[model samples]
Target: MPVQKENVSTAISSDGGSGVSSDRLQAVARGDNIPAEVHKSVFETTPVLKINAFNLWYGTKQVIHNISMPIPRNQITALVGPSGCGKSTLLRSVNRMNDLIQNVHIAGDMQLNGDSIYDSRMDVIDLRKRMGMVFQKPNPFPMSIFENVVYALRIDGEKNRSVLEEVCEISLRGAALWDEVKDCLNDSALKLSGGQQQRLCIARAVAAEPEVLLLDEPCSALDPIATGKIEDLIQELRGQYSVLMVTHNMQQASRTSDYTAFLYLGRLIEYGPTSDIFTNPVLRETESYVTGRFG
Candidate 1:
């Protein structure tokens, strides 16, 4: 069954201030198919990211329908769907990576900490600084391991060697790669194994002290051992930073995420706690997808 959408606009409170008016979001999502309202219990903490009546298109082709959801702070939320279902597209939108693509158009409201990211006064660089992203493959620069982790800080103009070194160690340790690479900080990052390189990417993302981390299939290209290590790292990351991950692996979603959102054909089909979404879904389409009956 399809999700329902009522035309009534809604308002929310964040950090003791008013949030975006639903009227604005309604206009942003004009003519798009909005998903049903998510249950309040699905979110257990103050949301770090709120997406309301959001839609996206490339030229004239719509790729994301009206999506309204809240990503809880300090928890892992996974977006799961089949290929080309807009999972990656939606993830990229969090940090505005999609803007680099030609002919991209977007509407509706995306808020981080109750501030509208798309507002005219918002700074794109600062927005991305608050959110870290790790791509599907580990594309480390041809630099030393230490430099890779502190790249973001350097770009932001941090010149203190002590501060950079401290951040590098802490971030690498947080990503569970410090012990393995601490002795060889000056070695080329590309010389590490695929799993180590991916972990390095995670360390790099966190060096800037972002509030959220976005992973686009961070373990897709690795073997079982590497995948297991990454999964463990994700588990450790819980309660420290809000994480949003896009994964095709259903089992990985169940293993690592506290919440899950299901999408199909550019529309959100179902979303809730990870346990409920996997064992008991309210929608037949979600049940079919989880049970291996259909995608």
Candidate 2:
């Protein structure tokens, strides 16, 4: 059975938890200077990406506040929050996607595998090449399935047909789509169904052998069955790639992620093991949000 929100509250209340005080919760709601309640276990795992006091602003309005968190290597870390809470903004910051926008300024820094992402001499293209990103919707290229999967290699000047073919099969298999599309390798990727297209996109992302996978609501646009498949695929990728995902689905976050970070008003609230965050979060605000009480 699906874990219910009341069950989570009950589990916490049974331990004599009094929950967050109204004054503290009011302070958080007022955007007061409250330090993030990051769990120490967040630092116990080896981090593939380190976000240090990161902040962002669009024109004059600030969106992301001072936030610091480590994305553990080879594990799924989920960013969960209500709408307009800067989850996607923070995710985009990791790969400098926010750089595309005009008048967007940032403070602080993020390090990918110990290399500074905001360095003046950093190659944005090269930096992006180290990570693969999938958007909310499936975006299969206007090309054949084989081409779509091997597009990364092709652009990098890979000309060996045997090598491209090998990577294509391996990537598709890795995404659990090879068995479905093996016979139709030359077919246009657009001809596939929504789920297949999303899986094809995953295959394309993995084809590059990126150090990290960035998924922004990867399953939101799909049906229940498709969502399940994507969730399963994400779990299967746990040991092979470090995944940083932004998802609004509380259930999905609890189901697929090892660590969960709760973001509110662009500030990191609480981050810890998924089980603890759902069952015993240190803040009442977090519990209220996780349960069906509020966004």
Candidate 3:
């Protein structure tokens, strides 16, 4: 049996759930905006992360449809879409961040390295440890810079001072903030500039050595210079870690991602290599959205 795409404008169901319109989604996918020569190419490499038949709802409002995609290992995949299209919802779902919200229900399967993440035996604390997340704003703790970077390590019962220092230095350098904040390791993290604070947060996330990193509009609140620094850091982190970022900035998506997925009204409309999606999209809606015709 074929899976049906829901419409965006469907009325609320008797169960008080909002359903996604696959018709709209398929229409976008089959739309005529894409060039003829470019076809969706399959990557032979194994994916480190995969989602299949995924769906989610806040109370009765379903925000994510039956999304299925694979996030390749050692590569950057950007999720680009309009506001309220469930981009953040999906990002947070990967690490089970959505569990924090009240009345949040999730369905479908999300796997890491072929292991089910929602299994009853799955330890969320351990799951989160494998994946790091950076938010839209720079949220540094009130503690000193050094403490901020290695906070996770301390919480995990690492007591060696030398080990903490080494990890702190490495993480900060990985986040491109070592040179700027090396001398002020004892200073309060909150006192740093917005850009510095954000980098510090990244350093903190990387300190735990997570295999995958999730970023939710990490630069939306930053200036061009700060954003560029984050971008460079992401570029540097590629191949060493799998990075999945949700970004509204088209240029940033184009500049940073190897592959791109565009979502509309909470459904995946198009996904492919960045070059193909941006230069020669296979869907008319994708072309229109990417070309600024309509979001």
**Best model per TM-score:** 2
Q: Model 3 misses residue 248 by how many Å?
A: 0.4
Candidate 1 stretches with Cα past 4 Å from truth are 1-34
lDDT of each: 0.86, 0.91, 0.83
For model 3 the TM-score comes to 0.87
**What is the alpha-carbon lDDT for the whole of candidate 1?**
0.86
The candidate, 2 or 3, that scores higher on lDDT is 2
| CA-RMSD of model 1 | 10.0
lDDT of 3 by residue, 80-193 (tens): 888888999999999999999999998898999988988889999999999889999989989999999999999999999999999999999998899998999999999999
| lDDT (tens digit, per residue) of candidate 2 on 62-167 | 9999999999999999999989999999999999999999999999999999999999999999999999999999999999999999999999999999999999
TM-score-sorted candidate list, best first = 2, 1, 3
lDDT winner between candidates 1 and 3: 1
Provide the clash count, candidate 1.
0
TM-score of each: 0.87, 0.92, 0.87
Worst 10 residues of 1 by lDDT: 19-28
For each of the candidates, the C-alpha root-mean-square deviation to the true structure, in angstroms, is 10.0, 4.9, 7.9
Supply the TM-score for candidate 1: 0.87
